[model samples]
Target chain A: EAGVAQSPRYKIIEKRQSVAFWCNPISGHATLYWYQQILGQGPKLLIQFQNNGVVDDSQLPKDRFSAERLKGVDSTLKIQPAKLEDSAVYLCASSLGGVRGTSNYGYTFGSGTRLTVV
Target chain B: AQSVSQHNHHVILSEAASLELGCNYSYGGTVNLFWYVQYPGQHLQLLLKYFSGDPLVKGIKGFEAEFIKSKFSFNLRKPSVQWSDTAEYFCAVKAYNTDKLIFGTGTRLQVFP
Candidate 1:
């Protein structure tokens, strides 16, 4: 099976600029997640989608960050008026839902988009 | 709020040396534990997971982790590590009712051959 796919392996933008990252989850996966990993820090969950509907977005900075998983397959995360603190690796992952007693619940991650703010 | 902690920020070791990385989580409910490894310029990969059954779970590349419920810890270990084992390891926890995975700050390991 193919792994999760993300576009624009790297990106650079000035502060207050806008940027968007795209992700395509593994086929048949029903759950998708977006995480931001800062330097010297662990990855933090930004948003989660169960199929096309959002399951969680409590950590997402709605004022600047917005994400959507349309058609329950591809996802897009947009950061408008990006700030210096937004420079980090944006990772996308997929799973087969949280089904117990099964080995399909673990997530498969993408290479991630490394964003740099100038 | 649930959180994960990795006390070791960095570690250096010579080849064939035993390795241990500490990970602890603060959660009072049923949870799932996992260890993930990220090689240089690579995506995060699952090292091991402890959902239930045995407390000692073995993973790929000869890595293993012991889940101690009483201590709220899942420490990763390897009897003998190689230079190829150099990478960043992250510990994550997910509560039984939530799909969110709380991750700990990664521990970077540099193994010299």
Candidate 2:
């Protein structure tokens, strides 16, 4: 079984520029998530999706960030007009959600995309 | 709001030494807990978890954690450490019946050979 996969392992952009990151979750997983990990800090949830619908995105910076999981499969997260603070690692994870015995099973994460804003 | 806490920012130990890392959480309702490890340049992987029943839960790679409801603590412990165990460890918490996870700041463990 393959783990979650992410694209463009690294990216660099100027402030105010737009950047997008992609994620492909495990084949049968129903729950997908995106997190932002700033340097020296832990990963913070930016958004979550259950199938094709969003489960939660309260922490997402709506003013500059957006994400979508289309057809209940792969998903994409975009950050426009990036800020210097947006320079951080973006990680994607997936889990077999809501299954009586599997809901508590932890997520499998991607290698993550490291983004830098100058 | 639910939140997780890891008291140690970094820990260094020699191979074959006992290891313990602290984790605490602030949540009013029933919750689930987990410990995840990320080796250098690798993705975060589950080390252990506690859902219900037994307070002590064992996980992959010979790691285990004890959940103490009274103290609101879930601390990771390894009887003996190895160089292979050098990694960053994070404690995460999720409300029971919810999918969202709150994570700790993480503790970097360096096991010296």
**lDDT (Cα atoms) of all candidates against the true structure:** 0.94, 0.93
Model 1 lDDT, residue B69, Cα = 96
Per-residue C-alpha lDDT of model 2 across residues A36-97, encoded as one tens digit per residue: 99987899999989999998999999999999999999999999989999999999999988
- Write down the worst ten-residue block by lDDT for model 2 chain A: A98-107
- Best TM-score goes to which candidate? 1
Candidate 1 residues lying further than 4 Å off, grouped into runs, are A98-104
Model 2 agreement with the true structure over B14-103: per-residue lDDT tens digits:
999999999999998999899999999988998988889999999998999999999999999999999999999999998886888889
lDDT of 1 by residue, B67-109 (tens): 9999999999999999999999999999877778889999999
Fnat scores for every prediction: 0.68, 0.59
What shift in Å separates residue B19 of candidate 1 from its native position after superposition?
Answer: 0.3
For candidate 2, the docking band is medium
- Model 1, C-alpha of B8: deviation from truth (Å): 0.3
Q: Candidate 1 clash total?
A: 0
Clashing pairs in 2: none
